[model samples]
Target: MPDECVILADGPAALVELCGISTLERLLRTLQRCGITRAIILSSSAAEIARRLARPSWARADLEFTIHERPPGPTTVQQIVDLWPEAAARLLLIQGDVVFDIRLLRTLLAQTSSAMLIDSSAPETNRGKLCGAALLQREWAVARNGSVESALLEGLEQHTAEALDVANQPLYDPGLRRNLRPICFPAPALANKQAAERVLFDSVQKGTLDFPAWIHAPIEKFLLRYLCRTSITPNQLTISWAIAACLTTIFFATGHLIWGIVLALVVGILDGLDGKQARLKVETTAGGKIEHHLDSFFDVVWPIALAFHFYSSGRLPTAFYYLVVLLAGEGVDGIAKAIIYSGAGRLMTRSICATHRRPAKYLHLGVGHRADSWSAGKGSNCDGVVGIDDCCNRHSASSTDVDLAPKNTLVDQLTINPVGLVLGCADRFDEAVYHNVVFERHAELALEAAAYALFHYLQNKRLGNAGAAILSQNAERNETHCANFATIVEQLD
Candidate 1:
């Protein structure tokens, strides 16, 4: 592989219902126009649905347009890495639902430096509403991990002033991502009004969209003016969006039906402005990553709270439906974001950040499969996703597992969700704080919550089919590594 960029297609459902044939065709056209050849697509069980219903010519070539079926329940995102560690490295990862202009994607990649595709039209109310997209350079593929989503989450959790204590101490800390170029790609609304209208129309025609057609059209005059206000930084606006989303959750939980819909609309619009702010000001920094983290947090927590509220109000059935939509949307996008970031993080951390430093020895066990030929620098820990020191020749069958497991107690304690255990520590933060007391507190609480969720689901038998259930179990198991992240941070405190 000549260091290809990966494009992640989240799942089958988003592919068919969200993008439809026309939108998907448009995206393909854009990709072709932009000169991007190799990419990856993350598919779900519904992938078969899209293939059966709206079959496309590109999909016929399974080798080129690879669709990694999302695993059951929580396992959806991790499955991409668990299954295809090789392709995970070189990909222009993208989700199914998010529709971006091919021109913008090209513009994003042209930066040569680190760049993110920010939705300039993302409204303040909707700024952190969804996962923002980014364009990764070839060098980023160096720090590859099975789950790019986990990598960023790890970054966010470790984003404090004291995170630098582990540097040069047998620890790898890609100093909190500070300055990456953010290419402000105007949203469909601002870039192409007609395309934006068509997207909304398509959603309505499919009946998959709950909001009205006007929501996707050009921004309202007042909203535009509000965004132009001088005092707001994009991060503050994003946090405000989080607060609004939190409010929406509270309203939904309280049985405020009409208000919930209105709030959802508000959230959607608010999310439109984030990219705009970044573009207008040309502001990209470590602080921006913090905003991105806030956006992801609200995406997860808000809908979850709403679902719980509806369930508590005796509309368990309806709540389940909403819950599924929320989870599916977030889960699929989360996976895509992970795939995209993994490629980006690799270049930034390895070649850009670590290029000047001499390779040092670090001890850690290997979980998933290791690359037979490809490997990272000496004593470097290559997580299943990226950071390879050697090349993997797919033709060879050197499948024997390696066991240079670390003797560190904390290393042993690290468990992965949807998989079993996360073996390698990406940064020294894992050693210094992840195993400390503050982290212990968050870990205990998160574990309790995970246990409770498992018990509830099992009792209700919400695992759906056997495959889904098995995958769900695997995902939950793997998530223990990610879920305990907060606790790890508390340890630093």
Candidate 2:
């Protein structure tokens, strides 16, 4: 509703120093409290704050807020336009030096014009006047490829004649124009529009307003361009990133917290880049999937192992038990995937002729759920039922069960026991994270089977000599930890 606004506080420490500590703090608090929908602040300090506050967000919608640390020069305007070309809305450009009564902000919001304010203190007394504040109209700027700054200059140049209609014709002349007009404000003046501008000027004179590290942002873009080249493969990049993650984890675990944290940060950055690089490079493969799986697998193990090592050294049983349950859950989940896929294959070969045949069989065999057969009158078919589709079931045996299914006899086709499926699912869940949607949709049923299997295995493992036959039977039934391929092959055959 208020359009797009940028609070451009461009100046050396002088402008910042002018406002002093109290003034800067007030400005930060006020700007944050300001109800503007999109606020852009050009400051290194702002960037630091934003980074420090970054966290995983599950927002229904995303809002873009950018803070640019403008380099010294008149060209700072160009930098802003480059950042947001399509945001042709209004802009509130606040100079670092100009402090104002909150009312001035209210008045600026109300104005429809491309406007600037006349600092009540003219510092004709000073070297440069307060050309700091401006109410920018998007349409007025030169939008050469949507450059808002150019649009601002263009609009200002074109609309200079119209400036006299708004405020103080006597104080601000077109002769004072460089693409903006000055709007005069009266005091009891709730803010520092006067001293603030001077601070900015002084900082500029001192040269403390250094260029930002934002140049790294374009590094992603550049890598994006490199990605356009036909050389890199996503799997390779993923493997590289995985190696980096492993190294980072090792470093962090081995008495090097600072270096490890730094490496961890790099790991995070590269972790983000690997995917982006993959997208940019247009490379995707089964190996990419393998890489993803490995990444997630390590993500679960390494962190917990680190915590375990730390806790174990301190003799903390609580952490050990908690991590054990988590590891148990992960193992359960992984094995569950293998079982579900295997069972899915078996059911596909069924002769149910009924509409609910396949997934009904899957659900039954999956978690030991009773047959949920659809009535013949129901319009839905087996195809509509989820988690039991032929593709998934058929594919299962190809990967996990290929080696094991052949030598063994098919004990029961379309077996409605969900025990294996349940155990497999439970085995694969690492204990660190829980209840994520990705797990819910993909891992739950499998985990159920895994939990069942681990229990069965542990029971056999416990019985020692007496349970030898049971252990052998269990081992023969499930040779691999994950047997999805076996399931797929069995179903297909």
Candidate 3:
């Protein structure tokens, strides 16, 4: 909420590019996110830097930039002070030699009284250094002592991720213990851009990931390094994947199911990349809202397209595909996620559904449960039905049918909540990651669709929220190894 900011863009590293944006622009964006609408930048080439900053942001139409020519020092600082608005209550001082995490600025801005940003990391060995940024009283003159109250920077030295620090650190209440911890910083030096880029890219990853996202991460980042350098914007990246996903309709309608599925999976990778790039570049916009509608559009379109294909082929159980498309597709599930998240304040979780009892006998078929597969049958369709082997036998193929897929098939995994199979199967090392969602078996397929509805329709569903759930069968499915998002849970309680 700081309205006025003075950024020292004349510094040695100010104009240097890190991950396609200059250090100065990164400083401005940090201000942008903090709602600092008025900025005065100090740089010898101020006009040039200002020209590069005309890019659009959804929340930043009110943001204004002005430039003063000089290497910032006493003279330039005084000029900025003279030009500072008379009615402004405070001015935020910033150094433009490094890239900062926005959470760091938020921590600073949340302060009730102005204080200088301190490098409290090595206070013992460090004699003193100048403040990196500060919120100052607008009626400013050089402090005779050049002194400002120090707000302590607190976080575990062992923690490297900025988000972990931002999310996990506790700020105790007091006039002063009220201070929140700042997150990561990497100087934008020529020798350091690669490491800075890595740190920035890694910062955008969520605390939790599904099996698919975890497996896809390496390739995603590998491609992102080049894509970030291109002129293609995040919205364009979003549009590109959406168009590619829409083409899946063509593939499915034309009897090119393999291409359709392949393109669909690859679209998942692009979908993730667009979000990362948007965060990395701080380019949140109305286009982001568009991304969601496009996602919903494709989510419905692709399934309908598949239904069209199945219907045209005159296949058995074509009605089932239509039911799945109409019922389990995007819009309803997305609404479920929003409602659950709002009520529980728990993200990346599922709604209760299809409460059917598993046939305890064929548990290996993902009908029965494992120890980690936490729950009593949900109170819906699953409320009373247990030991459904009679039903399984009535509908399912022989368990030993060799014509069907082996346990690792991807289609079976996708169709049903494969957590049980993956947990119990000996072949499950990467089976959780690589299994297909459908099977080749003629008769067993019926049970797969039914169980998926009975189990995964809303039960323990983990799609969307950009894979914010870690996809575990246990009650701890929302938890992660590093307790990365432990911050939110603690704050709520």
Candidate 4:
């Protein structure tokens, strides 16, 4: 059996952009995450793609990418057989346009013979879609000459084969008959500007912990669509927002409360953009780290600035109390994060041990500690959303593994405090945390602005009544939103 996986990247689907990244890049990253170090990409624009992948961000030192000019008038299977006969028996075939769970690929790779994944729960029109992925034996691929769907069907008729039903698995195939659906795609149609905007809005993380940012998601999506088209980097967006946040600090310090509040909201929107842009453009680890550090600095400064504003307004008692609460709340949140990380480390250790013991079954799963250097040491912080390695790490412990056997110390620890596990290691947890931390802080800032206005009004009605009324109204809305966010977080826990 040949060791190389074959990716078909010649179709229109490969050009489609989902959540800011090209479908082809997503496919390549997925393969790398599965420990596939060699891949043969069949693309019509092979030269262009090869140039793009030469960049450090897309190129992997461990992975050797071979681009074959896709031949016209021949289907993917036939083209592969004609060009790469040596890989006939051992090819993992994947369509460039679709986004599928890594778990499905792991399952397919474990199969010894030709097999195809079918979504049993897909709409009737999509019944034979094959999800645009298959495990092809060299003999089978060479013997057929049609669409992958037709070839798979013919192979099934000719020989005994495995047709794994992955209807329950997450899949995002734009070629399917049905319209967009589910959290799997994370987007809608990516056909045009209007459609892309809808895709961005739809792609916003919608998990329980994401409730805090749900309100601003639409506006963020609007900004994201435009940002995606520009050469503006994620670091640029982060720096721009940081400047705005600094201006906001000046406004509050100078008693220009309304302007401060408005600028703060702008900062919030821009804050949301940086990460969205990063994920969309497939930015480097250094870019993300820069954004996080800048964000952390401002996260501390904003509250301190607000406390100063309150102090200067002759509300010493209120200012001190607010400062204490804000500081304490942040401290507690930090501790919670630390605990979650510690728990995740424990879970990962156990999972790695189990993986080593049953190497074959877990081969396509976690890459263990060695994965840390695969993508510039970003694997250690595998947020599970952006990087492919992280995504695999998130799902490394399969459902069967979770269900089996001995209730060890690690299992007992997880059972006793599932909050850490869910918050730290779940597939969507990092996304939830990314959006929630920014918007949640914005929510708290809104409340602080409202409190400042109310206190100012009480100190001098003539000077503050109008601002107080507006701020109070906005605060009420934000407070209600915060309450809803709290409820969702509680439910997640």
Candidate 5:
């Protein structure tokens, strides 16, 4: 991948704001995240953009951000190259008007020395017209009159095979993603956008939302509409919700069920906003761990408060017994989850993050089959979802997912090379290339080996569902999403 980029900052769309930030700023952040070391901005309105754009303070300290208030002409190109000879090696040139998915950049970076982004879904008239981005080398000569748009069109030669291809594909189809879906990003660049605002909200949405959160989505969106316009930050929302949680406990302890229920529902909905606002505005913090403990504390406290209310109001004769049962169940569940997370730590985290952090609505043992059923991985999401290595393919791919076991089939093939385990060690910073080891003949040993491999990795990611996030950004590093587990209140409702 190219380490540097040249963004042509121009046009009204370049200044378009989404989630309280402009497109230029968003692109810069994305670039920094994707490992861009140096960036040169060519814009007539460079000074104006600097005034309006709020660049991220957390961006790489070593990243060079240079702005030139001119078009991409021979003089300008020569000036950039003379100052930085590394530009001769390779660099990506992007138009400021085009807000794109990072995957497109990744795809372009994977190409040989030079390539341009191709939007197969683009209209016929705009086919040769710039998709507004290209990976370039010093081999291409810049004319005296050249603009950023003309840089990609330097030669009449059209090369599409090695470059990025945005095939016209169904957004939900994971099979088509093998082509890398250059244009068909899980969160498509800014496709189908009236304003990037709606897309920003849509991008943060998960596949399986529990009932309360399902109910809360639109209400919070309405609230977010105003929140995005303000100076209020994510930590502020977190603090507000924490304060509201205390108020909820007070109402419940006072034996006011109606007020408690209303307030609790309000708090549950607002609980989602802080993270949403944080992501949309790119303001996530490490102090979020404090928020996690507070949430867990409230989760335990709220139920106790409700039980106390039931007893005080004489709403139930067996309220004390019910409270005991609730505490016992919570204790058992928490311990089991902790064990699972600790034991299957790396395997589960890598698998889940690879599948785009969408919590599973369905949990299956094997790739495509349900826990109650059995079938070879076909006519389902087996092929595209599981990263089956040579070991599994040589014998059987019966057990590829975490947290599940087959009832009928247990094909044990242990006399194979540990390619998956080896691949898992290759990139310590990335999601594991492989994560499963199933032994029907010896389930305990399988679990132990898997546990040991996973435990050593110990990434902070939590375990999630199998093949659940196939249609989303599988293996998107550093994506922080709150798990919306079903609560007793939501379940009852």
Candidate 6:
């Protein structure tokens, strides 16, 4: 049980920034989260690092951060022992470049004896490549005179070392062996940057809508990593994209089709970036609220503007009527979604009941009527019992149970499926739903755009113009799509 952690934050790698935060800052934050009250940061330029960390934004009032200049020759363990003799009894060693999960670190610290954190999933030869973190007892660090890895290996050989299985944990090692770059770093900083982007990417939520955009994920991730080094906030990005979307609408209205298409594509990419940046930076809820409203505004206004443009050009006569239909469909969609989420509590209760029923089946198969005996009067009466008393009790208990049952409150409901429950406290079911709905809406808009493009294509034909007929057919198709979505709402009702 380490009372304090010693971070070896010496080298260019320690200064590497991710999501606008330095590796040392990230490490300190993780240690704070793990409830480590004290830490000593050993760096070659201790004063410079300490000065940089003195900013009000980087302040951690609870944890005491001390910086020490790294000695010229001795190993990190040996230096720690020579400098802070008291911390030798229970010292936690962390390599400054390694980006890891706080939960994993806390789990490692829970061990009773000295332990080395290893990724078991790595190849047998690579398994010895520890993730730059280890728990060492006091005696283990005394007079150690090599690299941290070498010292850890010697300690393991000399003592009964417990290997902390970090195979499934989110541990990013940017050491000599496992250098995850491009996604984690730019071309120049590939060797030095901590693999924080890899950890952040792993943390990204995959929603129902995520599959359609899977092709663009790598591009978005690349751009996100690049943008993270900049001082731009996520909300600022959202505002910029909103302005671009508005410009896109203007371009469509002015009949600049190429500019409109280009801006629309840019808007789409920025839309993805805003959310990605927000999640990575842990932006405020107000930022997300602003994003949602902007998206909703764009979703309705963009198509309406395009339709108006077509009507003004004498391409489609019933554009206003089509706009009306679109608005009505969107209203119906909103109402339907609200109703569905409202009933989620009842559905969740039934789901829980179903889950509880499985064990009773197993118990019945194993113990027969004896299971019934224990459950007879205790309100566990499921079905098919043969006594008059049981029948009477079942009937009489049903009403009382219904009356006494916990109310199906909205708070108890989970909007997403059971698999989403695995996210536990980090579950953003509403956010997922919003993203899915936006994707579906975007798909509808794409279909409409295709229809408009087809109308133009037909009008340009040398022999005959079938633009009116094509537009009419597209209008009917759009209506059909709306009706199909409405039918889903009806079914849910």
lDDT winner between candidates 3 and 4: 4
Candidate 4 residue pairs in backbone clash: 88-138, 89-138, 186-203
Q: Which residue pairs clash within candidate 5? A: 354-474, 354-475
Ranking of candidates on lDDT, top first: 6, 5, 4, 3, 2, 1
TM-score of each: 0.28, 0.27, 0.58, 0.54, 0.57, 0.47
Candidate 2 residue lDDT tens string, 291-361: 65765777686667566656756755576677778888887987997776665434323321222122111
TM-score of 1: 0.28
CA deviation > 4 Å runs, candidate 2: 11-24, 32-34, 44-65, 70-72, 85-87, 120-131, 143-493
Pairs clashing within candidate 6:
88-138
**Candidate 2 vs candidate 3, TM-score winner:** 3
In angstroms, the error of model 5 at 338 is: 7.5
lDDT by residue for model 1 over 377-396, one digit each (tens)? 12333222111121113333
Which sections of candidate 4 miss by over 4 Å?
Answer: 1-3, 11-13, 16-26, 29-38, 43-64, 76-90, 99-115, 121-127, 136-149, 154-166, 170-200, 208-212, 247-257, 281-297, 312-318, 333-493
Error of 4 at 257 (Å): 4.1
Name model 5 segments beyond 4 Å from true: 35-38, 54-64, 71-90, 102-116, 123-130, 134-161, 167-196, 285-293, 308-320, 328-493
- Which is the winner by lDDT between candidate 4 and candidate 5? 5
lDDT of 5 by residue, 154-268 (tens): 4324432223345421122111111123332221245545445676676554443367766888888888888977888888888889888899999888887788888888788
| Per-candidate clash tally | 62, 58, 13, 3, 2, 1
Tell me the lDDT of candidate 2: 0.38
Ten contiguous residues with the weakest lDDT in model 3 = 484-493
RMSD of each: 23.7, 27.2, 19.2, 19.7, 14.2, 20.2
lDDT for position 247 in model 6: 94
Q: In model 3, which regions exceed 4 Å deviation? A: 44-62, 71-80, 124-131, 139-182, 325-336, 346-493
- Candidate closer to the true structure by lDDT (higher is better), 1 or 5: 5
